[model samples]
Target: MTRTAPHPRTAVVACATYLPSTLRTTAETEERLRVENPTLTLPTGLIRRITGVENVHVAGPEAQASDLAVAAARRALEQSPGEVDLLIFASGSQDLIEPATSHIVSERLGTRCAVFDVKNACNSMLNGMQVADALLAAGQYRRALIVTGEVPSYAVRWRVDSREQFLRSFGGYTMSDGGAAVILEAGEAESPEPSGGRGILGSRFLARSEHWGVGTIPAGGTVNPHSEGGAYFDMDGAALQAAFASVGVGLVAETLASIGYGVDDLDFVALHQVARPYHDRIVEVLGVDPERTLLTVAEHGNLASATLPFQLAEARAAGRVGPGGLVALVGLAAGISLGAMVIRL
Candidate 1:
């Protein structure tokens, strides 16, 4: 039997983003790498040419992932201080492995909302959005706050033995520190002012567990308790590229089809800020106009789960997304997962 789709009752009311003050330039990073490996020979502008990232933000030593989340959450709350019935801390970076980070975020925000964490690598925010959409649609909750704080710089290994090691860790240079929060409210509730059908319409998610090892942190988990590679982030670049080339486009197309829309229907698209090449490939595969999407990698690099929300907020501020316009938020995570959410703004 076919099942009916859930009506979208959740709408994003406000969004806020917080980027760290410290900036790490590509030249500085290249210099550091060269100093560590004397024999290394890389083109002067190779990093920028490949990733289009000139600089990235670095969190202060005293800062933790939860701290950033709280900062962004406070800003979002200030914009729409409605009673948040639920809070989801969706981030790849966590303050601790024991207690849920959502609790800490809620405590700092002074909200007694029910809290939890939803992790799906870089797609954590999109996953959280899907969960929030469900709860709000079911009438189980009226408002939900989704927050992500990414401090990936901590996992970057500066010293490498060879070019292979450096290449494997290249993704690290693109890592940035930031936090983002979005306040979602049920659409059935009357708004103080009229919004032209601005809210989440639907979302689709796909996972390819076979390619799970394409991007991973080899240490710190039960599988590798001692960490053969010092718990640094590692990825098989070629494998990841191949996987995306094979299935990424199909996944996006299916997602759009689920909502009875196409790429042309999107007014603005917010894609994960992995790198310039990845972004270009996604735009090409999805047949989306590059001008319609916001590119943040050039300045902010990859903020993981915080990237999409940050881009969305910036696009809104620039008036790229307006009332009744459709916006597509797409993400690809380390689990070899793909997800797309179409929202009417």
Candidate 2:
């Protein structure tokens, strides 16, 4: 006999996000492109605007990873004042490799609850929510804070000599720096209805390890040794395209079925902001309602880990999503990973 999976009880109470103040427009990129590679075909200003980013602070040796978290947390607290019982920092851009960045954020936010970090390429936020939901279900914590801080600008390589390298700068210009903080609380009948009492139902992860090298920043890790070489983000764009085409279809279909619903049941779907053509294909194939899908790539660009919360915030502000809405947050990025989660709001 097969046993049924139980839905977990959880709710998102408040959310806050920060966008860097600096700006980089596509026109600027085109101008630079003309100077660097006169032969390279460039997207028109309107077509390439998402390749523009603005108002960002470059994280550096002296920059504390917790600074972005603290800024977002403060705003989150102000938005919905509370005493959090757990803190989870999700990112692909941690300040360091050793000591967890969560510790610094917890101390700065004055949250004494358990603290940890979750790293999973761009899906880090969704992964954090899954962990937070599990902890809440286990009675390990009553409330949790999920935060994401991005510094893609810090990873850019501006002096490369190859045209291939010039085109790759899309990652930098197409990416933006920002942070987000969200408060999750255990559902209570008296919980004042919560921002919708949206409980996380289930999540699915698809990791295609074989394509791990398709999209990555090769230079600074254990493999290449940053000390001996110049490190910058690199990608086999063709391979990533194939991966998205194949994995996106199955992962999305399975996720919807796992929740006993079709993609049409979703009131809103938030996908990772890659600003690529494949994003449109996935939405069409999944039959996700165009009106319900939030696309931030054209404006905010692709924020590695902060896309989920940023889109959710947009949906909320626009009143496009509300109580009783079924929301799906999906992400696909480096590591050839794809993740989808269904939340009942």
Which candidate ranks first by lDDT, i.e. highest?
1
Per-candidate RMSD, Å: 3.4, 4.0
Write candidate 1's Cα lDDT for 1-345 as tens digits.
Answer: 654443445788889999999999998889888888888897797888888999999999888999999989988988898789899999999887769999988888888879999999899999999999998878899999999998999989888887888888888888999999999998864332222245876678888889998888777668887667687878878788788677755666676777677888889999986889889888887889999998899998889999999999999889998777788899888878889888886
Where does the lowest 10-residue lDDT sum fall in candidate 1?
A: 189-198
Tens digit of lDDT per residue, candidate 2, span 235-281? 76667778777765577778778657788788899888676465677
**Model 2: which ten-residue window has the lowest total lDDT?**
188-197
Q: How accurate locally is residue 254 in candidate 2, as Cα lDDT from 0 to 100?
A: 85
Q: How close is candidate 1 to the true structure, as a TM-score?
A: 0.93
Query: In model 1, which regions exceed 4 Å deviation?
Result: 1-8, 189-197, 226-229
TM-score, each model?
A: 0.93, 0.87
Candidate 1 Cα deviation (angstroms), residue 251: 2.9
Overall lDDT per candidate, in order of appearance: 0.86, 0.74
